[model samples]
Target chain A: MKCDFCRETSVIHVRHTDKWFCEEHLVASVEKKVLETVQKTFMINRNDKVLVAASGGKDSTNLLHILHKNFPKVEALFIDEGIKNYRERSKSFIKKFCKKHKITLHTSSFKEEFGTTTDQIVKLDSTKTSPCSKCGVLRRYLINKKALELGADKLVTGHNLDDTCQDILMNIFQFNMEKLARTKSISPGFVQRIKPFRRVSERESMAYSIIKGFESNEGACPYVSESFRSLIREELNDLEFKFHGSKVNLQMIFDRLVPNLEKKVMKNRLNKCENCGGPTSRKVCKTCQILEQLK
Target chain B: MVTLEYPDGAKIKVEIEGSLLKVLVKSGENPEEIIVKKDGKMIAEDYELKKEDVVQIIKVGSKG
Candidate 1:
């Protein structure tokens, strides 16, 4: 496939947009969006300590770059999910990137903290579910915990527009009304979780990375390569090809519908988990359940 | 174990035991807003405790 920008025969067909992009353009676009996100919402102070959740992927790698470009107080927190070579390599990339930028990077391992990696969790389970669910819960808990541990005020995530859209689509599909209500919105907790790249597209993030000459691991997680998210992405990609600007259109539609959606679909009283007392829609929060499963 | 009620009169007679293993109950209810408290120190319903645990469950509602 010819790249949309470079017209190179070697191109990756992004499943959400159905556009083939050369590696360079892809990285450049991602960087641009990342920059835009950071500029719009993130106001950095000299004394502020920022904790960035880096996954060694393009989105995160570019986020680190943008944060460093505009702010001086950015550090990274990488949670090693204990996925064997996959995690080791990702961790190494983070270490190298941190060293190059001279940013203080802190590392946490699931094996050390929880006695398991996402791979181990998936291996021990028979459900064949995406480890992302477990990894996500662990990652979130640790991110918040570590952010507080490191005395950081805000926890920045590499969630881009496509990620947000996927979540929106997933919530809609699952009838997750409460999650739908807070889609793309930020809230505070013990540690504030913010997405500077929430408005950036995946493709744009990739492009931004290339333009800035940042190196990112091209390897996808072995388990996530065939995950349901990718399948949904492909489905969305097909839709976008049939109707250009579907993502933007979908975002518009969601923006209009979410007010009513929150009322009609998610009007149920919000609950606090009895276990951790965190915000939950059920009696037990998802984090406590995963911890229960691990135990 | 305490018998707590939902707004729809859905009462769950739970026995708070020794150790709490968090369980996500299947319901049309929002999981985040379900309040679990025992003896004025908030706890999950699955919290394993003694025999005489005073548990109260609260639900979020619209003020307007």
Candidate 2:
């Protein structure tokens, strides 16, 4: 159905409010709401530079596009994780999107920064640990470092509600207390990691991508074939369908518990890694350990 | 003085001076599960205390 607000909108759904919305209307709604949330939650000013972490996928691309339209001064950061076809396609999409949007794109690679990608690291030695962990760890380290280097006030991610809830379940299942403590609707860290699309669902993001004709690579990362996170994502999908408002419920739960949880999670945290002197709850930071393991 | 415990069977004594949040972060403690008490009454971390305010960090297990 065509959205009443915008004629270009295709998919329509009504919830919470009496207003019915098509894909365009929903995307616009999310964009507007996201801006309000950012403004309310963070000290975002006109002078503050935002670094949007782009994966060349629908969600990130659409987010960057919408954000650039709203804020007019946002740039993008793309990390090449060295997953054969996946990285290539994602990079291409990101480049095209940036070119179209006239936004500056900064590119970094695991191979360039760390002399390895998740693929190369996993191949160096066979272990039960999937490449996703390495990629995530490395990507996170680089993202924060790069954001700080670029002098960005905030690092925006494209994590939707589905991903957030799935992560909450994963942390719960694994008893990863440290991860759980900070996995709010908006994550907290040395650098502020904001998920403006936290309230938007994966399906809705997909619909928005389709309606907006935004470029997207819908394929799964090749290295994630053995990822436990993917398994948890599948399980969470069923739970989300059976339990309505799961995202909102989780957000509310986090809101009430985070302040306490943060104190608890960091209780065991060490001042600095003994090896690299980076922040950690252990003697050595995870990145330093991973790098050592790679060697 | 604050008593902080870890899952790995470790304990710490925290001296709350400036910001409780800064102290917690500096002590390598989780900012979420910290329990503060004053004369046996639970207090929020952000609450300012008089001289010699005793604080304790509580360890909470994750429900995996």
Can you tell me the CAPRI class of model 2?
Answer: incorrect
iRMSD per prediction, in order: 23.5, 18.3
Whole-model alpha-carbon lDDT for candidate 1: 0.65
What would the DockQ be for model 2?
0.01
* Candidate 2 segments whose C-alpha is farther than 4 A from its true place: A1-10, A14-20, A184-189, A268-270, B1-64
TM-scores of all candidate predictions against the true structure:
0.68, 0.74
- Superposed by TM-score, candidate 1 places the C-alpha of residue A56 at a distance from the truth, in angstroms, of 0.5
Q: In terms of lDDT, which candidate is strongest?
A: 2
Q: What TM-score number comes out for model 1?
A: 0.68
Q: Ten residues in a row with the worst lDDT in model 1 chain A?
A: A9-18
- Give the best candidate by TM-score: 2
Deviation in angstroms for A46 in model 1? 6.9
